[model samples]
Target chain A: MGTIARNGWASLEDIRDILYLTDARLDAIARDVPIRRWCECFDLRARTIFPRPKKSQAGVVGYDGVAAADVAALLIYLERLGYELEPLPLVERLMDVIRSNPYLTNAQLSVLWYERCRHKCEPLVLYLADAARPKLAETRRLRTTTGYTIEVATSADGTPIWLSASAPKYRKRRVSTPETCLQCGYVWTRGDPDSSAAHRREHKKRLSYLDPQPVVELVAAVAAGENTISVDRTSPRWKHREIYRRALAFKREFGYDFVQWQSDKGDDDPGAAGVLFCNAQNVIVGACAFRLREYQGRSWRALQWIWLAPKYRRSGILTTRWFDLRRQFGDFRVEPPVSEAMQAFLKKMGDESLMGAPLSSTLPER
Target chain B: MGDMDPAPVDVLNDEPHFLSEPEVAQALERMLNEFQRETDRGAVLIAGEMVSAQLAAEIRALAPPELRGKRINELLKYPGFLSSFSARCDVALLAGFIDASAHRSTVVLRRLRNDAAHSTDAFSLAVHRERLMQMCSLGSGVAASVSEFAAKSVLDDVVYRLKQRGMTLENEIGRNPFSSAAEIFEHLSVRPDLMAVLDERMPKMELAIGVWLLLGLIVHQGKRRRAERTTGDIDDAN
Candidate 1:
């Protein structure tokens, strides 16, 4: 007796194991005595199993192995009998159904049998009739609801098949094509009036998010040669919630996974110090955040996140005031995975001492 | 004819610290040696291009057999996917030929190279000193004027590290580099048209820029296939 590999080819003994049939019973069935001599009428040996050499023992052998496809076909044909060993003429009819739709796998056949064929005497005719009934009903419903005419034709065996579905004879409205904004990455349909209006609003909103308008004092300060302002978590100005909000937005725009500030955690450290850069028009075009950390008994100012508006970039706005920043935040160290633009800026500074160790190195270990 | 001449004051008395001929010669020699050690902006840019070209070659060699035949020059030239040095570095990192530090160094070098090439003003270490510092560490006593040398050293170190990493990867994979996701799927008998659709959609999803995600997918698929094989299951679900 051969054992079956899971999901692999099954021999006669394996099939007996699956069906819980005794060797005597399977042999009796195969010999065409039981199950109304169905196996004999259909010639199961000719259709079901093709002989192949055993995989375990090669060379000197007889054709003993069965193919998975042949095993599946046999299983599907036997499944029509259900739990009852008493066989019916339905074996040939199921074989005809399998021959017509050869692509249906054993799994699919099992599903179909369970859904519409199980416990029925004339499963094939009933299954075909049941499958076509819904499609015909759906066609009728579609014609009535959608004002479209659908044609259903029947084959010689009376299985209804769809011919075509056509719309009513009326001019169709053209669909709107989707358009994307190159600057802000906004996408909207072109021909839709409402969508176009929404796109305009979204475009303005996204631009504002990228380049936030500065407060009145900050604007006045920019005009007074005080273009940049630094505020730590402990600073009096930090009491205002607006700066923190803008900082969070800038952090999000900078692609940081978390926008929550360290100060928000209520740490004893000074938390983050933000330096906002206002452009010539007094718009807060850029922001840089730093954490004042004590490492190895020395204060280290680590750069957390830095971002500038797209237009104000490369204008030497940050570079010109770098010394002032260094003076304010002593021993500045940039975080790792530094941006290429920042790398260029660091190079432009021409100060090797400014290239401090990574921010992680400055943090206390857990 | 008598000519009246004024007495010459001895400058040596006033300046006793004036060097002898050999001392002056030695001093001049020292300055000349220091000048030779300093790498100019043009030299740094050229060195960057050279290092990038070599790194590109090493990466190309480590690529799968299908991509190995594609010329590095063609791939790293204008309009190519790996045209920019940054892109090449990213591909090298994704392909596992170089680690993150090496990738960062390459990026720094590329930035320095761009600054050198694009700057209209005269090349000065004053401009790119901090960037060069980011790539390579200098001696504690090293003068600020020798930043160009530091830049050159960083480029050399990057080239050497990349070469070593490529060799290691080749050894680990037994000279057969891991195939890309598309190639693996192709080997698994996935339809070419489906793979083509994936290829077209992947760039739109920005997956092409960061292809390590696809590499991760390939590894996952390989494991799943092995698991299916072990379980003796026919995996038609994919």
Candidate 2:
């Protein structure tokens, strides 16, 4: 391929070489006075579409310079379209459009012709006429006989502002099948780029949200001052249900072999009452459930499970809340087979007496 | 011409030979096949090291000047703050230096490196074949069958991108009008009243004075650059 000039401006000969046009043919096209006149009237040199003459040859310069890309696009359009239509009139109207819209450039017109009009069977004059429409020229809406409306809008720099074709939506719907993401359960249509991209974005988001590490950090960082609120069944049933769902999810994520709350149906289990720690966003970050049991004719609330986002643990968040729990439940006992971390926490709390004896009968079946 | 012994019948063999297009293509293909055969632990270690180096460069570029050079080395060296590959990756992601996909690929690369280094059994690409393939696919933006060639290409692409980002950030930093405390003070000295006010109130609090002056100078430089850019855009439109 021939190289464009470093200055971004090309001579007529250079343009002809890049376009692979014969010298005689380009000469014939350039001889048209209006084309040269339009070039001169636009002061193409001032716009860097043409190189300015050296100081010695200032006023003597002719229409020898041009932006190669813009001129190439224009020449290609002319060569391709001139055979079907009257070349002079087409050039005049195209120049008129260029002259009227300051933002419209020959380069943009060339792109529109090549991308939208070149392959179509429609007359080039009709397309040019639509393009010449005042104000509406930005979005050239052409309704084809085949029942599709093609809209072409050009940006200032020759790229499409937006291109759309109003085709039958039902045709695509009939041909495409919907695909469901196995991990996130997001459903989107196959072979549709927008849908596939959306599915990918949503899938990433869902994965990140489910990743406990970041959430634990965020909750830990924000779990101070009035940011966290403790909720239970007494504090709005909906709040309790939402926290209960998060608690279950956290349990499953922690790889618990068996969840105690899974046995209970819902908030209706009067024997079950839970406390949930929520962050400023009202998201459940820590939770614990207690079950009332009569041991030796004395009723006591037995701790079924206590869970906090890992980062929030050992931060004195739970220790401060212990007194409140003691006042509310009166007597609380933890189930046996406590984890080492929990045992350490219990030891720190001076509540080793809260540990209960192992009850093999109450254990869920594996 | 024929009288000079036909110029000693020179064979003209000393001229450099250039490969033809087809010859070059064939040579590349052969090289790719050879690269594909490198599925051993050595390749994983090399890939891990290259990625770590690129990420470290990017972090250096994005870090504040105070954190560059020795301070940054202190953080990234063994037994330092961000010594582990995992810690570096996490810090880069949190600092918005790399996106989630790149971070995930780096994580996968780190794990592969670990398995290759620490495993007692024979270590090869097969150890974490699925994860390696996924990382390559994400890095290269293509879903192809696994090969060491593809893995190397993906790593090359990642390193190239990080290097480019680092260069761009360095260029932007270089463009700042006041890059040092001395330069900032020199610029501020033009306004004697401002300097006088500081001189009176900033005797004991030298650190606070430097920070305040630096912030003001940065904001002023930013506004000036933005205005110049806007004017250039307007001129282009006109």
Candidate 3:
């Protein structure tokens, strides 16, 4: 076959090998995930014999049900660990190998690639340097000096209240202190007029390459088959209504089907600690806001907000972190990689499919 | 032939002084011979070295063999063994003088010899003729520097004679000397002064330069045809 044809169908064989799984144990895994065209006759091929020195009862060396089970287990494990699978297989493998053995320096991985996979050196090196490490700490610290909260008077009796301030130095201001409207009505400082007007204007500018954020945020809800992503109802600076409206507008444009509320996983609450949120490394460029809740004796986490810098697509780093986290611990209902133009983009980079089933999004038609 | 071998020779059992001329000759012979056995390309190279060494031996026939030995070594190392490349010069000259005339007809023979001396393959017959011509021209320069015998003229004379004796002049025009006076002077003289003078007076270099320009023009001219080829068939004329 020609190069393009060969490459196009290359992943199909791997997926076929994956779908080569059989037995009652993996049935839920097969059923719970979206079934593609390759799942049919998975059992028949799973049992086919090829000539080889007999090693064990398992017919093939690498394709046994145990190996498939190990893959599933790894997927579940990464979920718990809060890692994202890269859309590219080689990239995913590189990250997986690195994470599994962090002591193996990047040089050692590069040398391994040189020795075992000489032709793949460029991609391996590039992904490692550009995609993998950056994904680990893509959080960009937002310039929060301009963003402000407005406080309005809540007291029945008209009382002169400290309504406006620049960044407040420490003061013993009570929560019960008379709050008057500064800009709208919340208990935070307002920006200077010119700065506030400029900030408002900047917010109105539309940025392309910001689509990955909605997708990342909708991962959990998409898995659950839900339509709305949720952020905390009480962020003093930004209102929940605005956040939801923005997310829905993004969905309408980007075709994301679901969004769910995300609560930061705080200590002293085992249940809340399971929800996903932006980590220190993820603070600047990429952040996933998700919520974990119990449903039918199973924990379900819904991602409501995922924003990445416009520059980070195709790097495979952030996506790998997402999948790595899922495979390690979240034990999520798996999904296929993304499709349409995103698939084309990922395919150009030899990335795996990222359009996996959402942990909570609406189900595909049977 | 015995001198060409690398079998250990215990010189300690012999007189303790500088190696004799025959001894140095033997050493060079041994080095060249060993090179022959180790490489498939080596035999041709050894033959070239033998011719060069034999000619040097004849030139210094009356000198003390010891002085000749030291002189030979100096000559061998003149441009460095790798640069003034005696083995390659010998091969190209030998092929020109003794090989099939058709093989010698290729202007790239000198290049083929040089490449064979340093590398592992023979130049194929079907490369771009201009490239071969360039190689031959460059190889001639190296050969002239190494041989130091003013022998490039002799090779040119032989090529001219072949051309005069009703050999094809078309392929040789750009590459061989007889096509033009500048090339003739280049082939026949080893003097740097003479070549510098010719360079001032020559249009052949201009022609060579023009060929490069023409190549660029052809590429631009055929670009549409090439693009059509990429899309599929260029024409149904096939």
Candidate 4:
């Protein structure tokens, strides 16, 4: 508590969102690794992969099974990477593993994190840097080289090490007990460990702000059971006026979901990739669509649209599935002059610039 | 849409640049030199007494609230036994600031520096190949041997990690100011505010130094309590 004297502590929800995004790497890993059946679980072999690995037998096998601890990526990838490594989702089938499994270890979580964050680590680094920017008001004694990074206690991701700050200087002469320097002639004793009480809380509580992933996924799975999240198709339930009116009302309240996504088969670009967020029984809840579009004759990938049903906003679903979006569109640039809600989401992203140049055709009125 | 979005990603065309291995090694050397000058009296002796004492304070800060003041003074007696600059490099590695290769280099270099410091005769890289062979990074994978050039090359990249290149000393202090509290106290003693404390009491320089030491001690006592101090906490005391 003393370590954090000035700044306000983040709420559980704030921690949840951050942990969710950090764990986005895990979600990515689930999607990326190729899952050939090896008994009950999926086998991730280094040799099966193309390029350098297939030439020589350097590849080792890894598995993602139903068990909690059984969650490592291919061994070769592990050797090449560390906490900073972010590997892309090589297989789409890990989705089933993630969807079905409830428990995962810290190591497995890290591997999944790498899979989600693979190649996107630089951005993740920036994202963390944005949130845990070195404190501005922090003062240092000039000439003192003792360096310390006031750790964002809740952040799961950031620079792993900071300079160690020392305690009071003490010395012992002829006496058995050492006397500490106290200019005022005050008596002092080495206080106690930061927490004298039993450190019964697992390392996660000490190291991380909150335990992540399992519960959030459990909630999502429960919610998934109650409501459907379809890949692409939309249900006729969208035509129901009462539901439509409520959806519109939500749009009015949240400045999102102004209109239902009308799948335009005619305007389909082969480069266009999309997914739909569906409610109970396939009600079109939300859709995030991306397409490769030419701008000023320069070709660039563009986010066609990200429409979410009002209720789902801030629910962590969008962020949880954000890796899927990146996997498909390769990090789509959002059209600027976005809706207020979209802007809020971008701000959450910690890098507003990801909302790149606005779509030429879908221009918001100035 | 009349206006086209510039494509959301083009604005971020440039990625952050990282130094190559040689450059990183050079930077490590410069950083180590700077750290020595800053922490020690410009000598690279066993740094435990200088840096480790400060680091001890830090580990204490993270200690349970009760152990704040009286813990870990034994380190002062046998300072060299506590650690070397290489151990600090280990902390840097643990902190994830430096990558694996850099960390490996630190382990290797720490031994070389220790050997050179303790050597009776003039120390040379050429003579230390046997020692170099002991370094995990420099050691022969098989029952093979390494050339002096190879050991020297390892030594080059084995530069220590101090402050990151772009990060300011302020940033490092912001993270853990008390680790270098003594230096900070010395630095602050010359400040106009601290001097004003002297100016108000007595203009004599000797008494002022004594007063400053007392104040620094008092500040150290404040370290025992684990709470953020308001700006007034220190200023009003003065």
Candidate 5:
């Protein structure tokens, strides 16, 4: 089979040459995964070059019946939950978990790691105490309400070690700020044996708010510019045409006639700025698309873009460019901005709608 | 060359190929079958503890336990309870569950889903797709473009609606509203400012959605007002 292009574009030969699976492998894949469901969810056209299992007289069951379905569902569920299945970091973590428990299966180790994470608040020493066999003689050990366990010990010189199973690289923690006892309002300062009792009594509430204001200042560049708007195709939000809706809305409200497409073979003529500007460096903004002529109807021009950078927007540069456009194109016959709100705002600012010009047949799109 | 058509290619090419509808449908059927199989056998049941506790108490009460702990847990793992399936069902299953209280949300959701379902019909998905295509200006393959756009829209709309209602629900509980339009906007996981920051920042359609949100907020606020008034009256009487 011909090699298939990863981008979905392929010649007829390319389609015919790639490794075309027989009906059996396709059947296996289809039977095992919700790959079709996933494809449909993402609006992809999928084809199975395979056969499927024949329907049997099985009773209608809800969410139970097959392992294949569960795995497929799990894959999709993980995707929906924003879990990066293919991320190297996650794979590395999974490997680490497996290595930590050499005897545990991947699934069991994963479950244990997740379950153990739930007890993150407990100190490592306390965990050691719970699991380790206690010494016959009384010794310093961490204890919890559940029970006492063996604790890691330090040598006479205080090497800070855990010798039970010998996990050296994984264990490295130092008490920075001493714990404080809330009941008596005493700090566990001066690392002494007596401070452990006080440390056990302290319980400080961890504080975190949902959304906080940004610490960095938002930067602005130039305000009003008749520049074309370009966006990355792979942008998460733009992939769904959200920006188109917003741009259309902006046009409708500001009374700008935005051309959906440009002529495939047009010259360097500026398409339109929708709005005009009196000054070039700092111009008032306009709403939609615009077309212009500089040399007495000879040089047909169009200002093709509107600057959308934050720096310009915040400083009201776009707004100013729009107002300036009115003055620059006052002599030439140009479509006036006709958004009710825009008109009112402009009228309030003493920019009246031209009296003699006929309103265009095309209405500002909503 | 004049009369006969060209011969069809024999081998599959290396180019990316999307599955045909029939292929997709068959695959879905097979997946459903497999799903049924995995769920049939008992899995690691976690919610069994709850059932066991209840069963223990019932035994002490001199009553026979209704079902085994495992049986109760088996019921909870139904696809309906899973968050991903729940989201799908929210839009797909709404036609069946629509009621007086949820009618409005359901109607809006149905319309959005309808738009999504008929995405290929240019006229239907035009409004949504054009926005993504033009804004993103993807130079990649059409399938990739569509996939990216569709995926983003699903999450964006879900999170947007959830956060919006979540904020309202939270405010009803006598807490400071930790959410604003921005938070909901962020929850949509898209830049809120970009909608207006386009070179030709047009907000007419957005303004309509804004109007809808504003109306919803007004009603929500009105409910709060009535609630506050009743509490104030109670305080005054006391």
Candidate 6:
């Protein structure tokens, strides 16, 4: 096989090259784990090279048992990511990175980490908690009774830490300020811990009237002249198209469809927002696809995105940029089945229909 | 070169939306107002809106067509029993519009309101905040969204059940009242100021449904009046 290009998924040849292994050794490794599983770690599940598991009376099993070369390609991906391709559980290795890095702060960084690891980090913490072990708490991803998704990480002392998986590290933002809690019916001042505490007591016990208020001082953002464009499977720019493909693959894991892709082309609908991220130089850095659907009898825009590229990763630029899209879309909605990172961001932002943060009136020439 | 086509991406089976904390709060207010209005309907019934047989018919017209012919005179005539807010809640719940949780909260709110209404002492939401929070929290299933976490919509649940029933049932002319009701309700949710004209908070889904029902009755009544006048003219000509 030809040498793999940048942003190309691992091919069997690429895998063999990365492992520097004899074809026989690669075969043995393939027998141990399917290459598709490995590619999934890198958010490459949508690629054609990915193995499709065969149907048998033994029941539908994993991806069509992968080739040695496929496994080689996947290992190469890990090595490039600086994650050793040892036989250790992938999640453990991911956790190792997470534990050592200590800087997955804010939505962008945290999300970027997940992207770098291949959107496969969830399984690391998966099944960690079981009913029998009080200390080993399996985190439930179910929406709260009030409808928000707050994935609380607990301290050894059993206190809930409002860990921010998304943007704006909420290390201590857990006191339930009035701007944050959607499940309660009383008014509490934003950022006032005392009022928040009092509100929580009333909320947990169930007292008060529903107080609805618009968000105060939402930040304005402008990514418009930033050279954004959508990508499809046919796009020669592998990096740009790969983001949307990964999103489609992710949705499939949850058993549903997201933005339509007509073969390698995008869905016919113009409303479909697909992997749309480019810099002023028109360099691809990210992807975002959204559409307006009838929600509860009203038109609501659904947003799904991957702002995971290195260029936009560290700073809060991607999130703030994504927020800018809402200005073009007046009061677009954000909904469920969101990633842990997105959920944390939504929790902090207070789940109103996002109408892009307003652009700063102050001038800084581009 | 042509590449193999990728499968079309579509929104998944999972429902996704973008309701903020304030929107959820607004939705909750609409729901509480929904419960309160049912009680208010009973109070208004006591105020003798039922004195006009036409008004009674109009209220019933909002019901399924089969129930539209049923005389509401007896329901209207019962002053104290029908006037009780809890009784009204039971009717809405039993009508299959609200869930068990809403039924229970309505009864609880009725008692709380009664206490406030009957108390000689000055009633303050400030003093009652804790107690009110505890009571409203039961099935209200809401959390204060000042700063902790955000999710849930009191309005969604309220309207989901209502839409399920309303969409299936039609008026005398066979029009689904649910579409009109839902559109109007959605309009109201976005307009807090419009909602405040009647009350500081918007009235709930029930009131919007109520508007549709009353409009149907008025339209039907006008048609009947016009038909009668046309027949009388023919008789005069003969």
Candidate lDDT scores, in order, read 0.49, 0.52, 0.34, 0.36, 0.33, 0.41
After superposing candidate 4 on the true structure, give the runs of residues whose Cα lies further than 4 Å from its correct spot: A1-267, A279-284, A358-366, B1-238
In model 1, which runs have C-alpha deviations exceeding 4 angstroms? Answer: A1-158, A163-179, A187-202, A209-217, A220-228, A234-255, A260-269, A358-366, B1-238
lDDT of 2 at B148: 33
TM-score of predicted structure 4: 0.18
TM-score of B-chain for each predicted structure, in order: 0.41, 0.46, 0.22, 0.28, 0.20, 0.35
lDDT per residue as tens, model 3, A1-366? 122122322222343333344223334454555333212212111222233567665654432221222233222222222223212333333444444764754333442343233222111001222222322322122212322222322223433222221121223333333332433222322444554455455433322123222222222122112222223432311223334333443344456766332322212223221222232221123434444545665555433344444456455645556544454334333233233654564455444332343354332221
Question: Fraction of true contacts reproduced, model 3?
Answer: 0.00
Model 2 Cα lDDT, one tens digit per residue, B1-238: 4554444443765322222234333433443333333435655665566566656655666666788889898988888878777887888778766666667767877887898888887764544557665564443533352343333443343334333333443453334333344543454445343333233222112111111222222223333444566798799999
DockQ score of the complex predicted as candidate 4: 0.00
lDDT score of model 3?
Answer: 0.34
Off by over 4 Å in 5: A1-65, A69-270, A274-289, A292-337, A340-366, B1-238
- C-alpha lDDT (0 to 100) for residue A120 of candidate 2: 43
Model with the higher TM-score, candidate 3 or 5: 5
Give the C-alpha interface root-mean-square deviation per candidate. Answer: 25.9, 19.8, 39.6, 27.0, 13.5, 20.9
RMSD of 2: 36.2
Candidate number of the best TM-score:
1
Report the Cα lDDT for candidate 2: 0.52
Clashing pairs in 2: none
TM-score, every prediction:
0.31, 0.24, 0.17, 0.18, 0.18, 0.20
Docking class of 6: incorrect
Off by over 4 Å in 2: A1-237, A262-265, A279-283, A357-366, B1-238
Considering TM-score, where higher is better, how would the candidates rank from best to worst?
Answer: 1, 2, 6, 4, 5, 3
lDDT of 4 by residue, A1-366 (tens): 111111112222232232245445533553443232221232322122122346568776642222222223432133122222222332232434544668864435545565454433221111124544543433332112212112222223333322222211212223233233332222233333332222323332321111111121112222212222222323222223222333333344346644333332222235544555543322344555555676666565676566564445677777877765655555457865477777887788674776865433432211
